[model samples]
Target: MAENTAERIDWRQLWASGDLARFCFICLGILLHATNETMVATVMPAMVGDLSGVELVGWSLAVYEIGAIVAGAAAGRMTSYVALRTNMMGAALVYSAGALLCATAPSMPAFLAGRLVEGFGGGALVSLAFVSVERLFPQRIWPQLFGVISAVWGVAAFSGPLIGALMSEFLSWRWAFGVFAAGGVAAALACLAVLRGPAATRQRNDGAPLPPFPFATLACLAVSVVLIASAGVDVTPLRSSLLLAAGLFGIALFFGLDRRLPAGRLFPAKPLSLATPLGNGMIMVAAFSVATVTFTVYGPLLLTSLHGTSVLTTGYIIAAESIAWSVLSILVANTPPERERGIVLAGALMIAGGVAGFAYAVPAGNIPLILGCAILQGGGFGIAWPFVTRIIVTAAPAAERTVASSAVPTMQRIGYAVGAASCGIVANASGFAGGLSSQTAAGVAAWLFLAFLPLGVLGCLAAWRLPANSASPAPA
Candidate 1:
């Protein structure tokens, strides 16, 4: 047990190998997505000052999620027909174009369109990167590599706010996007130079054409998020209730349609059930994702409004979570296979505690407490997520590895969509829509974090139900 627990790899070997370029692209792919997301989110408060979008914030996020959902679903199958290099370059170019559009957008509607496109491209990049990990890296180092991926977000934690503030305060919020747009372009060029062949090179051995795109499934996902977002924008007794239900139904419909499809499926078999490890893992992912995102959608605004915090400070405060997530993930990266189940469950408990911590801390207007809560939340996910991901990937049918790997981020976005929409509804109903004030801010802050407590609990339960054994690591 000691030997297994203490075992370590020559981490430098990862970058020393011929696969280094592929790995760099993979990291770049995530950085492109994470940095854009973080920067935009950081600058949103200032952006709204230039544009009238106080109410449309939820919709803005939801549209991006819709685009991401569509892109994530199709990215897996695209590899069957297109080379990974080409697909990555195309996705990066799309991201660059979207960022360019946003940088130049004059109206809120145009901004929304730009965000949708960015999400589509970013989602594809991330999904493809996930697939690359399975294909390019040895399984034993997955935890370390996943830590590296989390570390990218940690870098984003600092870079996002610093750059976002520099542009939003010193220049223009639009220029911030212009810089990141250039990054997407650079990543695209890198992809062109580095990667080769298709993602699932082994899967297409039968030499058959892939199935048609699942347009209906994508549409269902889009509509569901729209309805939920609409409910958040206009909270009412009957209207909001109906919209929420319909939105959830749309998600269920998407799964049913996806399962029935002959190909181009988004998730593994029995995705909605709890009987299988994949199902539990999915539920845990969705639940925890739903539980945590309220911080993202509402955290900065609330902090600025309630506490008179600077926008830059608020951004970093939010970033504290990402940093903690990275630090803890890297610390726990060496966990042996035998310890995965316990660690996952422990992480889930910590996550639940973090949400509860936010419930108390955010409303109380304590910066230190809020930051602590964020660390708790992020740290929990950091320690557990790689293991949870490994569990899901291992439990997945051999043929569905690509789909399963990609599903992690897809599920996270779905959960974020739901969480963001729900936050809007809770905030609006708490009189935040009336306008920001001390009393209103307190109410919104309290409910926004509290409302998701059930989701945290659900996450814990789902984690508890996950399978005990993970796939054995390859020999070092």
Candidate 2:
């Protein structure tokens, strides 16, 4: 009992000893990346309207997500070759350039190119931020730091839509991109300042030569996303089916090849299985992400068509989950270790319930119910995410901690890409491709939400399987 008590974290003391300014700067990096994503999602409709690229709008998100996933996977190892400060500053610069390109893009193709570039930088920024948490802070403070980062995402959820809508409505959507570009610059400058001196030297000394890039896996993943995205376009059923099959096969190939690789691997061993703590946590993250992202990808469109909801209102509704998640995470960030399993289970239930509720709420055109469901879903993730993250990071071998930390976001982005594509398929098949009418939108909503319920169930099972015991450190 004495030994157990001694190991418990003292949050206050940890914070007191920490460098607040440097932590803030690290949080800022992630905030900028998160805000850019939400802002683009909000402003995309206006951009498409003005740019006359309704058909290419989905491609924008698809390309960005694919680029982000690839970059995130590579970032874990990339940091090994470069100093964290140098790497982060370069990524921020790239993000700024991409935002500038979007601000001035003359056509959809150009805009898509910009999005891809933006995603690469944004993805690296996020993954590197996670890695920084492991390298910079003590294990005891991990939950608090993760909570702070979640708070930043919540802020983005609240502000991103409002900022994007205001810019698009009162000024021009181009101004929104400009705003994000400015944020990138600020993040870059902050990284330059805070990540210097002894800390910078420590990071560089710990790093190693860059390993081989996962080119084959990257190619497979990229092609899969492309095929899945292409299937969403107005196409014959047979062609769409073939595209979907090809994409699934590509994904299988990626996993197969990834498992065969010895050292320079993209994911941890048994990444998709529930047999290990890291694998269970990652699989849960992926499954839950896939189930929940249906709302983000298609909720706004369906609600606008069926319920006559304004774009701004729909954005807030979609963001309700983030708000709930942030609030819940802060409330439980310091939960005693003994209660971690309970929280995980409760969070999983909330997510599954929320997903099930959305299936009915959207088609019924019930605004309050839809918002409630969103809150439930978001709250669930908030409760579970920190604990899962802690387990995965702590369980990894010291040498692979960066890779393990980065894999959480990598899995999440992969899940988002796949979920978005899956939703597109269901929507098109359910008469959404013809037009965005109330009836078609409702049909799509029903099919989309229902299809994802199985994923939610699988997520719950994974969460339940997580070991109650603190994960043992991997063999050195």
Give me the candidate number with maximum TM-score.
1
Task: Name model 1 segments beyond 4 Å from true.
Answer: 1-27, 79-86, 128-154, 191-206, 396-402, 436-439, 467-476
Task: For candidate 2, list the clashing residue pairs, or say none.
Answer: none
- TM-score of each candidate? 0.85, 0.84
Query: For each candidate, what is the lDDT?
Result: 0.79, 0.79
Off by over 4 Å in 2: 1-19, 52-58, 76-86, 130-150, 189-210, 274-278, 334-338, 390-403, 437-439, 468-476
Q: 98-173 in candidate 2: lDDT tens per residue?
A: 9898999999789989989999988888888887887777677677678777677778877776777678768898
Q: TM-score for candidate 2, please give it.
A: 0.84
Judged by lDDT against the true structure, how good is candidate 2? 0.79
**Residue 66 alpha-carbon offset, candidate 1, angstroms:** 2.1
- Alpha-carbon error at 401 in model 1, in Å? 4.9
